[model samples]
Target: MPEGSLYRMAAADINAAVVFEKVSKSFGSHVVLNEVSLLIPKGAIMVMLGPSGTGKSVLLRCLVGLIKPDSGRILVFNEDLTRLDDQRSADRHKLFALRRRFGMLFQDGALFDDMSVGDNVAFPMRQHTKMSEPEIRARVAENLERVGLPGTERKMVSELSGGMRKRAAFARAIALRPDIVLCDEPSSGLDPVMSATLDDLILELHRTLGMTFIVISHDTAEARAIATHIGLLYQGKLQVFGEAHTVLQSSHAHVRQFFERNTQGPIKVL
Candidate 1:
């Protein structure tokens, strides 16, 4: 079956958490995403794999309403994100409401250096909700505990090691109990053991919270361990996407080349 047809069939399911319909984006003459269509089901751990400039990050940004696509529609929980314009007040409100359902863990942790760990986790709740100080404190503790950073609330961001900082960022990501969590290179900058630990943490969080996770990563081992669904983007197109096992076993040239780590295939080294 064609990729578009497969995606359309999957998108027809009512349990889809996100649907990208022929989404395309361009930067001047350079095309980024070329009519990428996909369906991420609710509660799925989807790992998106690609080379550095294959538009994986662009797709994530489009999903979160940060960067608008030049064409096509993105549906989150049946609501069309492409239709919501931030320039208009009513649409801006809708966009904000839509964004509240998502939690983003940016690359480099993106934590405030000056703030305490607890304050960093509580920041979203304080901004988006009217929770009391006591309530915020309790929730912060709970999230910290969930991410295995318990009792480090007063620690400054600079005090934490690389792994600890990632955990702290993860703690903040789930602070609001979002329905979808977006992780950009969750295993980056960590040693092998720490990367595996983070992958385990992602699984634990998904199992416990039942949130859909969309992860952008280059770690093939991480994908093999945690991904329920897998996508490979190359040269601005989705070369392959499906169940993790199926994609891993794919005979497609791009998929095989990527999984096998071959130096020669359809994917040219640029």
Candidate 2:
């Protein structure tokens, strides 16, 4: 059976892929996230959108334990990552185990310039698994093909087009067949056509992989195209969150200003 099919089979047993209860994070005196609460269902495509520096990426990073919150609870795969202390042997073990359940696609592809595309895709597996080299190679090829990058395994990261680089990073992200995928600014620098294409690829992955997706982005079009759920963050707080249609219909001034892309609202043009 396919990995997605397996996830679908297990979906009914899982309550939520991720849950946040009054989560907050701060850097010294500057708050980045404030009492944000959310529940992300399994297999749902949830987009976290906001202006730059509004803590969109911070939310995703928190989900994967890359950023620890100062207070409140965040549950990813039932593990309280915020509570895990790497100082303890057992907690450190638990942290790594929980993190493995998630795959992340960072901005700018973040591919190793020296590694071949195939090797980049294979890197995660090599780091985390004991699979034979041939098996690892086969899985790398399959994931690359899934991202529509077939036959480019030997190509260097420098040799790829911008859009292709994005796809290649995606291939690397899914190499571990994680239960959830987190994307940071997946549409950052692409043209409309390529951005839409990337959106389609994301949709395909969610549909076929049966994994929950949390994307940090600012593109309204991409969110409208791909999100089943939407969360709007501003000034380090989640101003609104709900089903796509509900979020779109929100009457909040901040929400209105954001959707309208206007310079006249709460988001000051500095």
Candidate 3:
């Protein structure tokens, strides 16, 4: 059997919420992901760690069908995303439906400055669902409360503190009750206490909702706090991947260098 066929067979686990089979991508001559295959179990909080420009965010974008891989397959709930081209009218609905399963919190909050907090959280529902204004309002209030920002609905986005903005963004991300939440550097630009607080919010949401979470971060502390599964990508390859504790204990030079913050290891500054 061909090597690609073997990867497809291995990626066909029914228990997996997402799978990447021999996926690769390149921008011009710059290779971002090189045959990276991974299986993310249903409801697992998988934290992807890597140095800057190692394709951590690229992998996440591929999972959501925003960027198609150059080769291989990406499966979400057993449906292959690479086969569906969103730019093609025939595949748009299928692609949109597949994307609805995911909620993405961008590196920056990405909230609209002109919108009120309530309106921001209501945006997705208004765009995606047929819920009435009253119903959307109720759901908006509930999501804000879940993110510990209850009753701040009327405030402008400018009125929120940095941490509050992130929390508000979290509320919007979960507003539609997506099955998978993708957090891109949730703790970036925050004080340690605020970062910890965000981490706690993640834990609380995962515990209560039982949704799958894939977090992209440079923070080992965040991974230690919330990752059930962990993966480290370097130089366009996955260096280590397994349960959080197992990967933490890995003897891989790249993994150790990252977690230990050693400057003299295999990972060179770029």
Candidate 4:
């Protein structure tokens, strides 16, 4: 099916995995996100596109509760987020449990250079689980194999190439086998071939794991290849959003010019 039709069908369905409503955020005097709202469906790849500092990253952080919104609500699986409190407080335990539902692949991989590949992958399980040392080691190896990084358990983070580091980070992200994976700039810093390979790997994970994906990136080519849906963020606002191909075909000058890489369009050059 065409990508546009696929996105429309998904959006019309009532069972969205993640929903944002009238969300806004700011840093001091500068507004970062202005009443931004979007829905990312379950088991779908929703790529966020924007120029640098346009709140794409900010939006992701908001979704994970790393950054709170100044106003509006964030709902994951239809639960109010701002009400989340400590595990001991009322139904707050349920909200805290939701934290485990996501695995995030941050920009730059964020691997600890002091740790070995296996330890890096094992970090999350260590923090979140009571699993014994042996069990954690076993899980680490399994995750590494899952990411096609098997047998590199003792490898130091600094010794790996940029692509390898990204893969290792992916292994770490999936170690907990969460229901959603949030990736930031997943294809950045890699050559075209490596980027395509990364895209294929991400698609494979989506197909096999059935995990929801929220990818924040500016790479239009990568977005076209993997995004089931797309949203455009500009000037701290959600300028356009829909299925990937449909939104890209937008006649809105800002959308058209940004995607086409036209310098003379509505997106003011910095």
Among all windows of ten consecutive residues in candidate 4, which has the lowest summed lDDT? 1-10
lDDT of each: 0.92, 0.86, 0.91, 0.84
lDDT of candidate 1 vs native? 0.92
List residue ranges in candidate 4 displaced over 4 A: 1-14, 86-88
Model 1: residues >4 Å from true position, as ranges? 1-12
TM-scores, each model vs. reference: 0.96, 0.93, 0.96, 0.91
What is the C-alpha lDDT profile of model 3 across 65-144, one tens digit per residue? Answer: 77889997988988889998777987888889889999999988999999999999999999999999999999999999
lDDT of 1 by residue, 159-195 (tens): 9999999999999999889999999999999999999
Of 1 and 4, which scores higher on lDDT? 1
Clashing pairs in 1: none
**Model 2 over residues 1-270: C-alpha lDDT tens digits?**
122333333333466788777788999999998888777788889999888888887888887777888997787766667889888999999999988888889987899999899999999999999999999999998988898999898999999999999999999998899999999999899999999988999999988888888998889888899999998898877778888998888888887888888899888754
C-alpha lDDT (0 to 100) for residue 32 of candidate 2: 94
Over 4 Å off in model 2, which ranges? 1-13
Q: Quote the positional error of residue 120 for candidate 1 in Å.
A: 0.7
Cα lDDT for residue 226, candidate 3: 91
A best-first ranking of the candidates according to their lDDT comes to 1, 3, 2, 4
